[model samples]
Target chain A: MSGATPMLELRGLRKSFGDEVVLDGIDLSVASGEVLVVLGPSGCGKSTLLRCAVGLEPLDSGEVLVDGNLISATARDASLRQRVGMVFQSYDLFPNRTVLGNVTLSPMVVQHRSRSDAEEQAHSLLDRVGLWDKRDSYPSTLSGGQRQRVAICRALAMRPEVLLLDEVTAALDPEMVREVLDVVIDLADGGLTMMIVTHEMRFAEAVADRVVMLDQGHIAETSDDPPAFFRDPATPRARAFLSTFDYRRRSGRASGSLTKE
Target chain B: MGGAEILFQGETISRLLSGLMVTIRISLVSVAISIPVGVVVGIAMSSRHLLVRAVLRAILEFVRVMPQLVLLYVVFFGSATAFGLDLSGEAASVIVFSLWGAAELGDLVRGALASIPPIQYDSAYVLGLSRMQTFVHIILPQALARLMPPTMNLVSRMVKTTSLCMLIGVVELIRVGQQIIDFNRFQYPTGALWVYLAIFVMYFLVCWPLSIASRRLERRWAA
Candidate 1:
């Protein structure tokens, strides 16, 4: 009955979409203030793992616990999604919203925070993401980086126990990628628990306190020091991924260019 | 009022302006009702239930495939006679037009919602938003942005369709023009052409700004 335990725990998580088995039995946990990075190639189930963890996708089997409340179980009772926040690869900004409006929408609407209070919090978060200048501008008007940054603020405004970042920077350009990762790294510095699914080995190596390597829907290996993990992968899948990634890596390695139309 | 001078000369101009007003009235009501109705239907179409989707699909296809005039006659006259309902010409046109608007706008809404990349939805889920939160704050806004241009274009079509209400004996602008020209056949037998031209221009006037807005939005959002 610890009040301040780890924010999330995934035990034997399994999921499938129709006939596609997207997540096999997986086990993972995140302390309230830890930053865990999930790495894998495309279609390897990293994104699916994040979605299942946050209750976005129903799990075929196993349990997803957030702040010790069950989000999904073996019986498929998904109910703990309220405290886990997520950021997607595409930012998922409200196109009908100004940057500030997007940031504060949930708080003012769902949480019933007073408009002034929500605006106050929104402005502060927008300032944190360096988007205050664009607060009045719509998502359709901002650059990719700016919009994604607004998305991050939108996540932080909810005061979630855990934040799930699914390749957020994978859609940004090189320079813009740094801008977003920097925000995430700063959040880590401020003790936000984050489970990030990403391909940015450099960012992973630089920011992750624990690096989890997923391969074909299973956790192949996990290590405490990301630099060590990236430099010396333990599992064959990790080594293979590392080996392949090093040969033809893109220059600048930013996320904005990654989500090219 | 404006185009009659350009398209036709002499004493036939007064009748056309009156006809123009009818076109504007029908379009305004139909367009207003269509917006919210289409949004709800579009969202319903994305529902998971097979029965709901099947019913909505049937309604949409029925509206889409059948001619609007036919729908008008059926919903207006056929249903009214069978159910013993009272509907004036204007009332029938508005009711029929709303249904037509619902089907068309619903599809436009579906496309608008579809245009949003899936990544955005992923973001909302990860942000701990409940399904309703995601729809209101995230999905609805993005959908609304994409919905604007198409709905505007739809307003133009709705405006044009009001001319068809002449068959229903609505005293809208086109009917007014036809009635006037029918009475004043001695002015010129060509008065029918003049009257129709004027009615068309009034529709153009009412729907022109909407078309311009639609074009501007399309250009701004073009890939």
Candidate 2:
């Protein structure tokens, strides 16, 4: 990821929700097609950072640049949204629409693609995520994992330059988590630029090109070698968070291998 | 027995039917006009400008509290006297009902719009949908589905309230019933009672389906 052009950059990004500082002076950048995994405890501003990056939440201070162009304001240019796709923790699919409709909406509505073309691409994307059969199904009918997978396809359908996943699998059942993570793993393999917020330590270790530990509204620790970072974290906060995983592993609460089918 | 024969009279029946037509016309026209007006007003209620939302909210609140009869008088007698324009009773009825329906529907729409989760808006924004596009493609479909039952309830309410137009001399259903009673007062002492009962049945026949439909919709969408 070194010396690559920064596809997404957050310079001095600051946000607050009425005295509770959520994100404070966060500066980070992702190179084109690099997968950056963000790890943190609850209320560490990980979700807020992704929300700010996509302009869902207004910034208290600072700038977000995509391809080195300013996109800092809460009211960003409409075209810029096509550059960043976001998947929410709740799977935020439009309940009224069919799975095909959910995946094809922005492409047809925003990109103004022909119905045939949008559906054609939508079919391929759904097939990629192994949800082609569920195209006619509504979000309500699909499982939590299926819904989140469809959401990922919805974001991917836009052909965004940078995809932001905010705890995408956090809402899934234990048995369902692997299916969604597999879809994400495929995307990472395809060389898509992604910044994911997750608690799946094993999956983060396996897939992330670089790992960032966000603590108290700032980047407390970052390492290019995710395995090393997991094995031996440099910061006290990172060590504490990583140790929780060890405890979970010892207690058999978490899977030791994310690749186990 | 005398009024029972009057019930079979073609003249009395036709008079009631024509009054029914007038009532239906007023209700249909008012709904058509008010729904669009309400939608516009409702969308405006969500505007970012504090003053715009505040003013619209104030007007809707005032309309909600003020009686329809009072609004009818204000638009009919008050406007006629103040502006020196001789408005027809039908025109006055349409105007007043429209204003009332718009106010009621606008509030329904505002509440429905508000009831949508904030995350939906965030999803739309991140997907690059324009505000109008978001409302049309994303927000409106879900909101409208939820709005239908209450909106149908409003339609039934409006249909029932068209009876009030008699006070403005619109000669709607209730007015014709009054005419029948007065004409038969001496010949058939029980005529008033029968006429009112008939009016009650007519209202039920027209509005019952709407109430049933609203309830069915609530059940259907609840799942």
Per lDDT, the best of the predicted structures is 2
Clashes of each: 14, 0
Q: What fraction of the real A-B contacts shows up in model 1?
A: 0.58
Which 10-residue window of candidate 1 chain A scores lowest in summed lDDT?
A73-82
Task: Give the per-residue lDDT digits (tens) of candidate 1, residues B141-223.
Answer: 76776777888877888888787898878777767776767775765665566667666677777788998999888776653
DockQ of each: 0.42, 0.64
User: Candidate 2 residues A1-261, lDDT tens each?
Assistant: 577669999999999999998898999999998999999999999999999999988899999999888885778877898899999999699988999999899999999999899999999999998899999988878899999999999998899999999999888899999999999999999999999999999999988999999998989999999989999999898999888776443665574677766
Cα lDDT for residue A186, candidate 2: 94
Q: Could you tell me the interface RMSD of model 2?
A: 1.0
Cα miss at A11, model 2 (Å)? 3.3
Please list the residue runs of candidate 1 whose C-alpha ends up more than 4 Å from where it truly belongs after superposition.
A1-4, A18-21, A74-80, A248-261, B1-12, B32-36, B72-87, B179-197, B217-223
Tens digits of per-residue lDDT for model 2 on B11-103? 777788788889999999999999999988988997898999999989998888999999888888987899998998889989988988998
DockQ of 2: 0.64
